[model samples]
Target: MSHQRYEADLRRLFAGFPTGVSVVTAQAPDGTPWGMTCTSLCSVALDPPTLLVCLRAGSPTLGAVLDSGSLSVNLLHQHARSAAELFGSGAADRFDRVPWVPARHGGPHLVEAAHTIADCTVTTEQAVGDHTVVMARATQVTSLRRPIPLLYGMRRYGSWAEDMENGFLSYDFIS
Candidate 1:
């Protein structure tokens, strides 16, 4: 298979595995905010509360993150599709469209859109392919609401559903 075909196949395969959506945000030295919607976030370790996020190489958000040595991973809620789209659209005024406030550390926290915010300090970064894998230690976690995580998969959006019988939420892909 050609390289392009292989890449497409890999993306399709990963699309089958739905995951929560998040916005990785950082602030530049001049107080400018930068952010991008990201699904490539994962918990790396528990002992020190480590997490990782992959950001596109040369992205302004990535640059600001590196320069500031901090970031905030805002976990979007089910009602935050618009914010997700806005962040991903590369709009110059993306931050203006969303309601947010400065976090305790790192970048601003999406007030209405995110159910949780993890304020982290950058630990390490490695360039990989067209993206940079950023590792950070979460120094603070603020839970705004219960987890009705916004999910992305199969090129669609979904959310968790309450399973009353089990008294828990389950992956109920609406799309």
Candidate 2:
């Protein structure tokens, strides 16, 4: 099989898996706010509280984090579907539509839309094909412990309806 075929298969397989939605936010050196909805965030360690976010190559938010040297991974709640949609678009000013406050770590935090957030400083980064895996040491991590988190599956935004007897429960896997 071709390498491209393997990549396509991997994408399809991952897309079929349900995942939490998050908005990775940061500010440029010029104080411009930048954000993008991401589903590729993961916790890397616990002793030092490290996390990593996989962002598309050449994304402005990636550059912002690299410049600012910090980021906030805002985990969006179920009600933030619209916000997720907006930030994930090609709009010139994504932050204009959302209510946010400047994060202590030089980023924007959508307090109302997020269930929680993790502020971190960039420790390392690596290019992974079309994406960059950014490893950061969390400076502060906050969680509301909300019951429901925004979900993405099969390339669509959705919510955690409930645990049904019909095998329609939420997938317990996070990648």
Candidate 3:
């Protein structure tokens, strides 16, 4: 397929795949907080607790995260869409609108996020066409909220709602 066709098809294909939302955060040398909401976070290993995140090329936070040698992955809950938008935006003072605290390892952690995974360093970075994939070693993990995760799919956000039992065998059995 042509490059344009491939791009369009990829977008359509990805839209069908539901992904959990997260915000990757770090602080610059001048104590300025930086972050970006991403669905590109993936687990790379279990024994070593490693993960990967893809950041767009030329993002200010990307270079700062590389320089800081660490980052915190803040998992957004189903109710944190506003926080997600704030971090995803290109506007300054994104942190001003969100409640957060510094991670034990020194990166910014969203105080109300579902959870946080603190990575110590970028073990490797591969430059893709328009983004760079960063592999990091997780040093810590913390849960700030319940396990209800925020999901993105088909260009929308949705949550799993439990149906009450209506004398149905399947519902009663599960309940």
Candidate 4:
């Protein structure tokens, strides 16, 4: 297969797997808030509360995180689809239009877009291919009770639902 076709196929395969959406935010030295929408976030540890966030190697957010040594991964709720689209664009003043409050650490904590705000300090970072995977230790966390989390799948934003149709629970039972 051609390289372009292979890349396209891989992206299609990836979109089939549902993932939650998040926005990673950090601060520059001049107290400017930098953020980017991403789905490449996951918990790596439980004992110390470690999270891994992957960002494009050339992203300005990555640079700010490196410079400030801190970040906040904001887990978006289903209502924040518009906020996601705003952050995903190349707008230089993305934060100017969004509602956010300053985090004690550095970055701005998005008020309504997120259900959980994890303020972390970077412990390590490695360049892998075209992205930089950052491993950070959560220094503080703010979580809110929410009904459903925002989801990304098939190149769209939505939420997860239980399948309750078609005569469910039809597996043969021995009990």
Among all candidates shown, the one with the greatest TM-score: 1
Candidate 4 contains a number of clashing pairs equal to 0
The Cα local distance difference test for each model comes to 0.94, 0.86, 0.77, 0.87
Per-residue lDDT of candidate 4, residues 1-175 (tens digit): 9999999999999998878889999999888889999899999998888999999998999999999999999999878888889999969989889899999884689988999899999999999999999999999989865736788877777775545785443212111
Displacement of residue 146 (Cα, Å) in model 4 is: 1.4
lDDT of 3 by residue, 1-175 (tens): 8999999999999998878888888887787778998889889898788989998888988887888878888878777877777777787888877778876563688887645446457788889999999888888888776766776777776554455565432211101
**Better model by lDDT: candidate 1 vs candidate 2:** 1
Report the candidate with higher lDDT, 1 versus 4. 1
Tell me the TM-score of each prediction against the true structure. Answer: 0.94, 0.87, 0.87, 0.89
Q: How close is each model in CA RMSD to the real structure?
A: 1.5, 3.6, 4.8, 6.1
- Clash counts for all predictions: 0, 0, 0, 0
| Candidate that beats the other on lDDT, 2 or 3, i.e. the better one | 2
For model 1, where is the 10-residue window of minimal lDDT?
166-175
Candidate 2 per-residue lDDT, tens place, 1-175, comes to 9999999999899999878899999999999988888999888899889998998889899999999999999999888888888888958877877889898784798887899988899999999999999999999977766847988988777877666677575644222
lDDT (Cα) of model 1 = 0.94
Q: Give one digit per residue, the lDDT tens place, for model 1 in 61-87.
A: 999999999999999999999999999
lDDT of 1 at 80: 95
